[model samples]
Target: MTRVFITDDHTMVRRGLRTLLEELSGFTFVGEAGDGATLLAQLHHQQVDLLLLDISMPRLDGYSALVSIKKEWPELKVCVLTMHEEPYFIRKMLQVGADGYLIKNCPREEIVKALETLAEGKQYYPAEVSQLIMQDLVNGTPKVPLTRREKEVLKLLVMEKTTAEIAEDLNLSTHTVDSHRKNMLQKLECKTTVGLIIYALEHGLG
Candidate 1:
């Protein structure tokens, strides 16, 4: 039997998923949690085959939680179900060791299928997730390994905004924006703002 646990901030979401999962045979609903911290605590005493987790939550976000869970239970299966459809977050979650990604609005059947596939030691991402991944690959944008903040800076800089403008928008000091600009220039191998912008455009980071 597949032991599945649901970790989401919404009680209704957990209840609905639990009900649907229980209707499916060969899978057992092991537990439910409102946040990653509680999920972590539960895993200390329970054995689970799959974890259906949300992206945004207190204590620990889904990506970070997946990293921690995988370190503790290296074989753990985690399927990230989130409302955020941004490719950046999706890529980061997968890179950080999530087994699968699904938008929160995904169909119930697809959610079930993703959990089952992951539990069986296979991998699956919802259609929307796969499409974004393919687009990133085809455009060669996903290879740029930058922190979230770095990517944000790249986006703003590509729009011809100065470091001070980006600083104000991101609520950071001008010095910090300058530092990020330098880091971006070094990482992107661009000597000028125009060069950096062009590089970002070419790589689809903008």
Candidate 2:
């Protein structure tokens, strides 16, 4: 049986999760809680194989729970269950090693599929989260930290604008534009124009 754990602040949400998982075979609802701390206690007192985690709760949000859980149970699989549908949040969760990411608004069937996939030791990214992953790839400008002007410059790079074009648009010198371009490429780890273009497209950068 797949031992499942449900964590959310809403009373109705916990019930709904229980019902949804109970309806599926080979899956069992081992425990549930209204916050991360309570959920952590439940897991320690009992046993759970998979966790349905919500990003927003009264105490210890999903991200924090993820970090804590991995520290205690590194192999535990966590599927983020939240209303947040933004690409940045999705990327953050995945980057932190979340087993799966799904928007709470998804159809119940997709939720089932996510669980079943996770049970088989595979990651399942709901449509919304997948789009965010693409954006992460696209907007991977760099970790070296960019000044506001440099960011503006990289945005132009995604548009395939040359240094001259960017300089004209931003009212900057060609040398300044070139400097920003080099920084963007180095920070984002992009070697060519096409690489940056693909990165922008993935990250939903304009």
Candidate 3:
């Protein structure tokens, strides 16, 4: 069974999720928390395979919590459960290493599927989230074109490859990989690697 924990500010939301997980076949609702700090603290002593995290909360927000989670527990699977459908939020979560993303209003079946997908060590983003990403790309296409090599690097970046891994895969020096990343940022008018990834996803480069 997939050991699961929930972190949300709303009691009703947590209760509802708990009930759902209890009824599900492949999941075990290990615990729940009202905020990120408590969740992190519990994680230290609990055995959790998946985390259903809310983006907005008191004290420690989801973004901050997620960064800490990824840094401290790299193997933990996090599926962001939020009401926000904005591209910025989704991109930020993706950049922060969320394993999956789900809107609060999404059907329960989708949530089940997302959790199952994460349990199987895969990423999940429903069609609505994907549409939003594509729409963002349509609205914000950069004028400058990328070289073939740049496109290859961008693709690997989207796949969450590190600089060294990318270099090894492409048979290039880490310096060359970094240079390509910098070039892509400048060409795409993006300030960060996450921006490049978002752009690449929007443009179907991923």
Candidate 4:
């Protein structure tokens, strides 16, 4: 059986994960932790084949925890399950040695697939993540000439920030923000916000 551990701050989220993991075949729920400190401490005494980690935690955030865990337990497989879908976050986690990256909103089957892939000693990047990589490969170099401000807007869009929120944060008028967005769309040949987001991810601009 694959001995898996979970680390999430919320009790309910942990419980839900435990329940779902238990129902899956060939998986043994070894333990869980509410924070990164507890997880690091418990890992010293436990034999975990896989770790399902959340990015936002109370004591220690996922990035720090991942670095420490990878340093100490280099052979351990970590799968990041988080609500963050930004390209930057995804790239950072993979660079930190996470074996898999799955958005929290991904379907339940994807969770099982990720675990199984990890158990088989293979890396798993969800469809969304893979799409970014493929786009980068196909584009070769980012040909579309984008201004600095336009790039910032694209990054914010990839992070799911609304136009008004981005405008306020960037201290730009709403009309100006809209103009930038429209210009980016035209330059990138994208018809929607999602396409712009994909372009940003493809170029690792976010």
Candidate 5:
């Protein structure tokens, strides 16, 4: 059986999900928590195969908690079941290691399907999530217009090169390299290094 845990600030939400998941064969509801901290604490004593997470909670939000959970429990699968449908949140969650992203309004069947997919060690993003990602790509400026130097910097950045290393390799000062990184981030609408890397990989620029 797959042991699943639910973490959300809403008691009703947790109870509702628990009810739905209990009726599904092979899925066992292990526990539930009202916030991220309590959820993390519960993991210390429980064996969980998957975590159904919420983005907003008291004590610690889902974003920070997700990062911590992945760092400490790399084997655990996390599926974000939240109300946030914005492309920015979806990208940010994926960048931070979410195995799946499902809007709170997703059909009950899809939620179970997402959990199943993640439990099998595969990523899952519903059709709505795909549309959001595609919208972001279409609305954002084309990356091909970037200058050669900027593209070089982006490639090195995706390779995990530090600012100093990029500067040395390109024969530029650290300040200049930082400027390039900032510009790339702006042009790509990326808020973090991981986001930039994802963009590069998605566009085959990496």
Candidate 6:
């Protein structure tokens, strides 16, 4: 079971999340806090696997809290559960190490799915959030420029294609595809395929 903690300013929101977790089979609502400071304090005593955090809060905001959390507990999975859908907020949270991003108004099923995805050691950004990131990327520039072939490989990667499949589609050898993947990983400074996917999606390369 995934041990979950919630940090949101609203009492109703916390209660609602707790209720949801109680009804879910694979999740355990371990604890909650009204603000980031209290949440940080409680984390030291809790064995939490996942954190559902809100962006706007009293005392310490989510952004600062996220940075601190990641610095101290880099293995802990954090999902931003907020009403903020702006590109800036989404990008900021992802850059600061959010494992998932979900709007507060999203359906309950989506929340459960996001949690499950994180539990499986994968990142989750809802379709809307991804669209916003893509739009922002279109208006900006990539941090590290990618070659044309690299962009093609990345686009296929974002489509969830395997390396062999990508090679088949691009009429390249699997060895060549692997080489491209490695080069992209090095150039983008991504440690894993998922990180490469996130970076490519955020930079419009995908």
Highest TM-score: give the candidate number: 1
**How accurate locally is residue 100 in candidate 4, as Cα lDDT from 0 to 100?**
94
Candidate rank order under lDDT: 3, 6, 4, 5, 1, 2
Off by over 4 Å in 6: 135-206
lDDT of 4 by residue, 105-198 (tens): 8888888889999999888998889887677678753466789999988889888999899999899988998999998875665889889998
Residue-wise C-alpha lDDT for candidate 1, range 1-206, written one tens digit per residue: 99999999999999999998889988999899898889999999999998898988888767667878989998988888889887767877877788888888777889878877887899888777788778877986545567789889889998889878999999999998888888777555467888878887888889
Best by lDDT: 3
RMSD of 2: 10.4
lDDT of each: 0.84, 0.82, 0.91, 0.88, 0.87, 0.90
Candidate 4 stretches with Cα past 4 Å from truth are: 135-206
TM-score, model 2 to reference = 0.66
Residue 17 lDDT in candidate 1: 90
Backbone clashes in each candidate structure, one number apiece? 0, 8, 0, 0, 0, 0
**Which scores greater on lDDT, model 3 or model 6?**
3
lDDT of 2 by residue, 1-206 (tens): 99999999999989999998878999998888889888887877887789999988877777778888988988889999998776546666776789998888789889999999999989999766676667668987233455789768768887778889999999999998888777676556577767767776776665
Poorest stretch of ten by lDDT in candidate 3: 136-145
Q: What is the lDDT of residue 186 in candidate 4?
A: 56
lDDT of 5: 0.87
Q: Which lDDT tens digits does candidate 5 get at residues 78-173? A: 999999886667787877899899888878889888878887889898887777667767886233357799889889998899999999999999
Displacement of residue 105 (Cα, Å) in model 2 is 1.1
TM-score of every model versus the real structure:
0.69, 0.66, 0.65, 0.66, 0.65, 0.66
